[model samples]
Target: MQTEHDSTYISFSREEWASLHPSSQINLTQSEINHIQGLIGNLTNEEISKIYLPLIEYLSINMEAAKFSHHVKNQFLKKATKNPPFIIGIAGSVAVGKSTTSRILQSLLLDLPARPKVDLITTDGFLFSNNVLKAKGLSERKGFPESYNIRALIDFLSAVKSGEPCVQAPVYSHLYYDIVPGQYHQVCQPDIVIIEGINVLQTPKQVGSSIPSRVVSDFFDISIYVDADESHILKWYVERFKLLKKTAFTKPESYFKRFAELSDVEAEGVATDIWNRINKVNLEENILPTKYRADLIIEKSSNHQVDNIRVRKN
Candidate 1:
């Protein structure tokens, strides 16, 4: 890793980063890899070895340090060392592949020597339901920070960090395009939790000094931001929309069923417009501003391959 421009980050090229992988061989089976790879994501064994192995090595080291600190703290207080999850927050723009990255991390992290339990959750579930958004007139800004139930998200994180058992997180469905009422994913106190969302890195503003609450990112031991050129992200988003139009949107129960009737040309036009009006604005106004706050930044090429990595200097 090399420092440039007196920046807060130490940047590493793909090959340079790969050379730092842990000594022990770590193999991910083809089926496991296939399961982590998403429809819009590209990951091969080579990329894992090159881009992710070194990362896994780094995270393992940090996990060990966290355990040591916990042991030390508990010992000082004459208490047993209880498991406190090492929370990881992953932030990125829509279609920037954050979900795929989080899934890969969760899968690999679980296989470490301890065979720890790992849980993955997305901030999408924290988003307000369509009914709520429409009621608040934030329907056009669905992904914007204002559209989310920030208090609930932070409360859930607080519970997890405090080692609360069977903590439930709201469930969201892309088919319904909203949070499913009364459905939740129970998070049993795991060794690690990976929370992925565009809002993860954002530091919520404390308006008017109401009893200061712990921000969501504060609960994270490590934070990552997936980044790609806006043009590339725009293209990927449109392509994903087109694919969804043919598949998901065709389902009778889908909230976007109307989109299934559109011609290819019309679908692309609508997708591009949505990208410009909603996603582009959100990326520029909120998401991009928080990139520097992440502990690590994963830079992707136009082809969606991780090309460079930036780790914030200690």
Candidate 2:
């Protein structure tokens, strides 16, 4: 890792970080890790035992402390203590493995002693529908901050933190590239909630006096940001796009179906264009700026392995 500590974070090499803990108490198998892998990256069971297992243990420690704080506050108020879901926000640039990290955390969290009911939600579900974006002239900016229903997202998270029994989040479809109308993913009272997205750490653009100034991260008990060089992420994005052409894009109803027939050279050109035009802009302007706000940052190597970890000290 680059020379340590020019910032609020304390950085450690993967081995150093792993050595901080004697061993991972969690028993996740290789096949289980494969099942949670995302489109662009692969993770082995060893990586999990060394990196994520320690992180999971850290989160569980925080969860217990939060529960205790809640109990203390309730006692001060002479009210009954209620354990709310511990919310974690996972933010990173597209194709940098945030989805895989979220899924892995959700899986590990389930085995915690609390046997927490963990629910993973992607902020893609909060994006404005393509029709709405088109009407607002933000079709090309779909992944940008303005393309999300910020108010609705905040309200949903607020309700969840308030211990609401059930809440519905809009469903988004990658194949259709739009929100699935009238479809909602119901989240019951989970013990833990992981909200994953490129912009989960972002502050909403100020609209008017009617909206609160709080950001989505305000509801998080802890947050993680997956980190990698921009060059590496761009390459991953292109690679994923190429893979999608052979997979999802081959479906007749896939919005990216046209890409399925493109030659390898043609597909590379298109992926490069899309990255340069859209995803790169979003990453540079929105996503990267929020990385420092995360409580823990996991830096990935070119091979998509967790190479370093930085935990914020202050």
Candidate 3:
């Protein structure tokens, strides 16, 4: 039986979901188990189980629906036909846990009974290099839509949808805070492609218009936006910054190595300042505006649990 999370939609909670399939268990690989254990400090196993299991189930169902839809569309074209890959776009604000969500979904979706080959591609790879952004005088607008190679991203997606044998996408290195030249991820024909980013659903800027036009979302078969209050997201960002400073920033090659020596107070202040100056402004001016366009919205509370979900009606 389906349970309504709200008046308009029906979905199961983690506990309820667990009860439904007594014989089935979520089998995690050793590395995946370790990853979940690490997150145990901030999230409970039950929470992860409940939030993600259902999400994976939903994605599997949707992926099949997408495949069927593609097949039906192709039936009309006869022998000249090829179905495009189903593209799922995920968007959210910084520190809203969208990255974790994307990764989890990618793993879970691959484990489905359909056993569809899945590929995870992040839009971060499409971001212009620091030098390019600096030359264009847009370095400070790092996560802004204009900071990416929109056409290149679109071309990559188009190739993937067309079932190209091999497609290469540039890689972005968070440690170095730059695009690593000559390093790319090759994606073969995948049943589904998950594209995650800060502004995946945004409309591209028109060629000559003052505002940016939309590029990628136009190709998505389904889209999700991770949502939370601005204040809550800000706090999460600050906490994550502190955590990363204590860990990743200590690496000599890290772009934020200088942050490792900061006092807690100084680090908090710096994180707050960056949030205010860059992330917050970009969320307001670009990201949030596209929320309504999402097929589904996952709303999280300050504690990072998804308390509610909004699914658009057919």
Candidate 4:
């Protein structure tokens, strides 16, 4: 019930957000939901029905409006303006469910009546390689703004926005914690492209040049910021770290293999250290500052449930 009239977005509690689309059907099965959710757990089919179904409906309406806008522009130009892909940027801190949200949205959008071609691209793939980072002495700041090849990421987005038939993006492997050599993700004529990352909503740093500045988010038709209290994010990061230690970190070739044998207490300490030293710093310096830039801000509870929704008034 609390809100600011001057704020760009009007806030709504989770219950109110769900009530906005009471007729939204849960087309996704439990198995499907399971596959879409990332490391953070505690998701149920009912939660998906209440939270994401309404979100999908809201996005569908927006997408249709975007198409109509393109149509009108093309009409005024007296020429066919090729329909470019509708790009949605999802940004948040580590373990904040950006991947899960992107994957679920991709699935739901594809099932729409038009059956739009939805492509999900994570900005992790755009990170500089470990070798490159090492060469630049930036290994410790891997997820920081300067650690990414922002130019290349912007170029890839520009290509997609230009309605290019096919574009390739570099691939980064979480297992090795580095970019895979000679590997690229091919995005071919997608009707919608979801760009998920910690820094997708970030603005370009001033380079003190006369060159026109362009941010990665300039291409987005809609942008979402997954938000949660810093305490919740820290807890989620620690929990996911423990889960990975039991799972992926145990693999011999995993970059984090050394932590695999850590005792629960030791693992928790490492997780906390990582959060305080790197993730939290990055969140405060780069990620959270961009929350207001999003068209939608989805606030999550400590249990990984959507607690509320805020939509930009304009």
Best-fitting candidate, scored by TM-score? 4
Q: Give model 3's clash tally.
A: 8
Q: TM-score for every candidate vs. truth?
A: 0.94, 0.95, 0.88, 0.96
Measured on C-alpha atoms, candidate 1 has an lDDT of 0.88
With a 3 Å backbone cut-off (N, CA, C), the pairs that clash in candidate 4 are none
* Residue-level lDDT tens digits of model 4 in 45-108: 7777788889998898898899999999999999897888999999999988888888878887
Candidate 3 residue spans exceeding 4 A from truth = 1-41, 209-214
Q: Is candidate 1 or candidate 2 better by TM-score?
A: 2
lDDT of 4 at 283: 97
Instruction: Give lDDT per model, in order.
Output: 0.88, 0.89, 0.81, 0.89
Off by over 4 Å in 2: 1-5, 25-30, 208-211
Better of 1 and 3 by lDDT: 1
Total clashing pairs for each candidate: 0, 0, 8, 0
Steric clash pairs (candidate 3): 14-50, 203-213, 203-214, 204-212, 204-213, 204-214, 205-212, 205-213
